[model samples]
Target: MKLLVLMSLVYLLGSTEALKVLVLFPYAVKSLSILGTGAVRHLLNAGHEVTYITVYPLKDPPTKNFRQIDISKNAELFKNDDSLTIGYVLEHQVQRTDPLQIQLVTQESARLTFENENVKKLIEDPNEHFDVVIVDLVETETFAGLAVLYDCPMIWLYSMGAHWQPLRLIDRATNPAYDPDYLSPAKNPLSFLERVDELWTRIKWQYRKTFIIQPEERKIYEDTFGPLLEKRGRTLPDYEEVIFNASLIFGNEHDAVRDRPSTPQNFKFIGGLHVEEPVKPLPKEFQDLIDNSKHGVIYFSMGSFLQSNSLPKPLVAELLRMFGGLKQTVIWKFETDLPDVPKNVHIVHWAPQQSILAHPNVRTFITHGGLLSSIEAVHFGMPIIGVPVFFDQFTNIKKAVENGYALTVPLSHNLPKDLKAAIDVMLKDDTYRKKAKELSSIYHDRLTKPGVKFTHWVEHVVRTRGARHLRSPAWRVPLYQRLYLDLIALVLASVYLFFYIVSRLFKKTPKKTDKKKRN
Candidate 1:
């Protein structure tokens, strides 16, 4: 029996072919990209083969099994659009009409057309098969039809923190589009007006999906693969079902200050999976300064896309002035030189963020509340002052403040005073430091590392043949059902009718009416 079992195990291991995964990561500035690299690393480590499609050079080279599909050299439609570039959009898309997401959708659709044409040309030789396609959630709807055309399993990865909009869409729930500001948990959950706003967002997205994304996608498919497939007399799969990739992997931790009612079975929380080893060497000057400064160091970075140089001069000048007055040595991550020099302040074009955050003398981080930076700070157990610029940064910073690890200051023309006030508050409060350390401990006290959890899920899906059992039924149910609206309305109507009947019975109506009729 032992010999037979060993033989069976070997057979199973040997028979399992490397899962051929087509990874779509058509984003720019790949160096700072978290989701693409994270997904690639985990998939490759698990013995799955990956074909990465992207517009930028892969920042960290992949393992042996990984292959590259170079869309980086192609620059016809998306070359000029800054917002279409992934790194710029993340830090800059504050307004809903901010052209980046729109341009992303436009370029993604076009790229899908190109990719499909390429695939069709290659498949004529008859040696291509893909087991699965994993795409970032943003443009999955555009190119996902190709996955269906190839008859492959599809998984959508949420590259950022979770929110109701994406979660609802993933599950096929009633899509209530909520604006970023109104969706905050800091306020009451959802007011009536806010609920209306959400409804409008849902309506708009649905319109765009049906009218905009679908027809454009259909035309592309019809043009490229359309003729070849027509020769075989087969129509492509419906774009909606093809576009909606069911499973999701979120780059967020459950313990983080996120508003999650329950974990969706199909959704995996692998927040810190993309964390990288410190690659860049620390500057000698910065190292010497750190060694010399007996007082603690304060590190400030606004992330990659948003230039500190672009910040209104008044605010910049004021910030420089304040930092110069401070006793502690300050390291500011800036793109260019400042006109005024503060003796205490040091500016570097790029700072080794993880290394500095890891430093023993680093007391606090002043940041833009980007998730990666916030996660690092939490990992290091350092206190923070968050000055959020846009998008989910506001929510992230707010959550951090609520969780007791940080103070938040709004970004505006008059930022220096607010920034100084926030800094002073964090510096003075020992409790913030204590809380940060405690939360950091909680963040780390997991059954395994986040990447391990991520890997397990990826393998689990492939092994289980797409793990359809794990998908949430919540998406299948309507919003009204989920909200229990029918039940509430029934209860209210019953109470109202009961009160009306009781009031009628109590009135002295019959006797007087009968006497008047007789007269």
Candidate 2:
């Protein structure tokens, strides 16, 4: 009985050391932010105290205890700062090391820095301290120096698919190339020019970081953390040393995307970190429609940003014509009333996307290949016809093609008959459906749920003092050094020169001597 009581006491003591985490998202929280909501939900459920920071102030925010950082109040720091274009912001900020400009840069930086300070105050004022800081990749870069200021291990959580910009920046290494389809790995591969285009993108990001991003980042660190670290007799850790929570990238991708040579240790693909949440059932009418539709339904949505209402008339007319021709009942997530609606088509201003995807009668999804949409498609085993627009959407859809689950058509003023042909092939072909189900099987058959894996990893960071063991050491090698082909080229060149010289010296001169005698 005494032993049992001692064990119980030990368990209680162990449970009391839950991680105190700081999560930062520099952008507004969106319904589709899997990383933001997934991490927050997992941490909360795991009994971790999370101080989630965002730039936007909320009127009636989450009842759960979260520290929201509002940056709207300090918009004046960007005053007359026209030179710092988003494209060139990082570079200009880095080059202008003048105290005055650096001061202004630091002031802007302080707003984000202050948010971390606020979190620190919350902990320290109550005689508490965070075990770790887990930030979205974009947010992590903004207040990068703050990780040092707080003297805590940091985790960089990338919320999206393997975008070239983040991958190269984080690993400082390049891969062959990635398809836009997000799922397909082999087909519709990037051409040499396309691969060079990807390289160019990295150059832009590098320029932004070195010239603009790093300078501003440095200013913020110098102002907020420099003196603080000096007092403690310490310096900042190199960015590569920071543990990155990219494990999702490895998990959510289909075999087509992952089968390629992905550098291990640095870019951990731990995707599907979000799972379906319990929510109210869809309206009875919608459920009834799903029940009645014997012919599989086709779901059409343009995603969050580009509203259906904003679509050009030509595109709308083209879509309506295509839908009118379809035998399947078309469910369009349209925001406004359409002038011409086919009898077979149903228009609902807002559709429960996940709910719709979950339905068995739902056959095909036509989407913009947003990460969330693509993940949902994979989750539901629904083949998609992606019409990608911007950012990673192109690559996501390309990957889908590579994976053999989707077809893609560019959004343009004048689309050719090939667009219709592609759609017709997708509709008639059974291969897309079979491959999609295979991927879904893999997505669901993982050892652990995405949310659980994410939470466990986050906790691991706290437990292991930043999970530095997981970091990729490849970031240290310079690009030229990593290629090593340059060294081989030099070796080959030296051999060629040595052979050429020896051959010239040993060459018989009898032909030239005879010709001179004849002359």
lDDT of 1 by residue, 1-519 (tens): 999999999999755467888777654433334557777887787788887766654766765888866665444444566543223433464433432355345456455536644443544433666877776655335555546555666776665555554566456443343333222423336578766766666566557656666576666655655555555567766555555455555545446544544446776777666665433455787778887877789998888655677665666788899888888899999889988878889998988787787777877899978777778778778889987766456767777887899998766655778888877887788899999999888887889777778767666677777787887777677779989999999999999999999999897765544445554
Model 1 TM-score, 2 decimals:
0.78
**TM-score of candidate 2 versus the correct structure, residues matched by position:** 0.72
**TM-score per candidate:** 0.78, 0.72
C-alpha RMSD by candidate, in order: 6.4, 8.8
Model 2: per-residue lDDT, tens digit, 158-190? Answer: 656554445654465445465322222233357
- RMSD in angstroms, candidate 2? 8.8
Backbone N/Cα/C clashes per model: 0, 35
Q: By lDDT, who's the top model here? A: 1
